[model samples]
Target: MWFVKVHQNVKFHARETTALRTWVPGLGGAGPRLVAADPALLAVVVTAVEGRPLHGAVLTGAEEEAVFRSLGVLAGRIHAGPPSPSPTAVAPVTRADRYAKVDRHLEAARPHLAPGDEEHVRAVVEQAVVLEPLPLVVTHGDFQIRNILLAAGGSLRVVDFERSAPQPVVRDLVRLPDHFDGREDLRRAFFDGYGRLFTALEQAHLATEAVLDAVSGIGYGTAHGDPELVERGRRILARSRAGTLCPAPTPPAGGNPS
Candidate 1:
């Protein structure tokens, strides 16, 4: 059992124990025994695992591919599971909600944006709003390196599902390639695995925007009263407008049509 001290009134012990009980069965893990819980503090006792996090920037070519493969398979399993009956009752954040939050941030920063950049942001926002909604599935609300734990023998585990909730299956896919920018090879591996479980244009669209929205949020958040990240977001938005940023279908062997 491991004890983690957290902010006041935020206890991880009970929740971790409960989560382990609810989610760890048949996974070859013992129940997480809660050692303590306090209303005025936050902490949890969990079965500690010995391993370092898989960082995108530090991974070798092969390692990177492996990580993407793992992510894809894991995401498929999670999404295929039954939907959370009461998603809204949980700490769920929808794509629209995230988009709106980012929009508000962009609006507040409009005074600092270049004219072209401002228009680009507006376009992306509009496009996102017009996309059709896909069927909701369980999502790992936050699926980033910091939350994925890599173990020996190529086995892995997903930690920190506090934000988990029912969302479009595509929402889960978006986290993959976006997390590793410019790595098309790794992206393909992830997509290949994802394709085995899910095959549909609508699902692909949901995943596509989820990634764009995530990237947009990153760029916008980094701007945070600054102009640099906002400028980056503008460029990304423009790319999206040109049809270059949307997820592309695998081209035929001869090559894609102009």
Candidate 2:
């Protein structure tokens, strides 16, 4: 059967289509198959995968580790693959481009931030922006566990492509801090499945990304009356200030799996 999606914005429509067309092949049946797309109508039809959101699901430690590992494999497969052949494919992102995005988010967050908070945020971001550029990959944009689906047979599926784009590999980890914060075993299991580890530079970049995410989350949540999200954002920002948002990067374990 087909699942129809109607996008309110043309850009989101395009990103979703381009991502599905360009990277679904690498997912190995873990992602939806695009059936048809109409740019003018801002809609697309895709083959539906049956499952429920994985968030809040009760599972043993072994089961959870397996889920995270499988997710890592899926993420690695798509990130290592090439982008779309279509001319309309999403453009690769550079560090400068990412910094610009952070700037934009910073502006939105400034009004919500307390006095001096914005400057502190800028200082932290500046340090990260000076790092060397990382290899770009097809990132899911929002890689939190809530976006994943668990099938009856225990297989995992990823849904939603509107936010997909070519970005630094660590960009996908921005939303994952909550999961791996104090869980080294799970983190190891995940990278084991992905066949690589975050280098020191990538770890620093991930921390930077998380800071931006937190500020943006605070701004958006406050504007939209989402206290829970705002609280979560504050917690993340506190961690960032404490220099604990992400673990210190370790030596490279290996290269990305082909």
In order, the Cα lDDT scores of the candidates are 0.54, 0.78
Quality of model 2 by C-alpha lDDT: 0.78
Best by TM-score: 2
Q: Write the per-residue lDDT of candidate 1 for residues 167-206, one digit (tens) a residue.
A: 6766655444444356667766675555453344554464
lDDT of 2 at 124: 80
> Across residues 59-145, which tens digit of lDDT does each residue of candidate 2 receive?
899998888788888778878777433555666656776667766777767766666667768888889867887776778878878
| After superposition, candidate 1 runs with Cα above 4 Å error | 5-43, 85-88, 91-96, 108-115, 179-182, 195-242, 249-258
**Candidate 1 clashing pairs, residues 3+ apart or interchain:** 9-40, 9-41, 10-42, 11-42, 12-43, 13-43, 13-44
In angstroms, give how far residue 226 of model 2 lies from its true place: 3.4
TM per candidate comes to 0.68, 0.87
State the RMSD for candidate 2.
Answer: 3.1
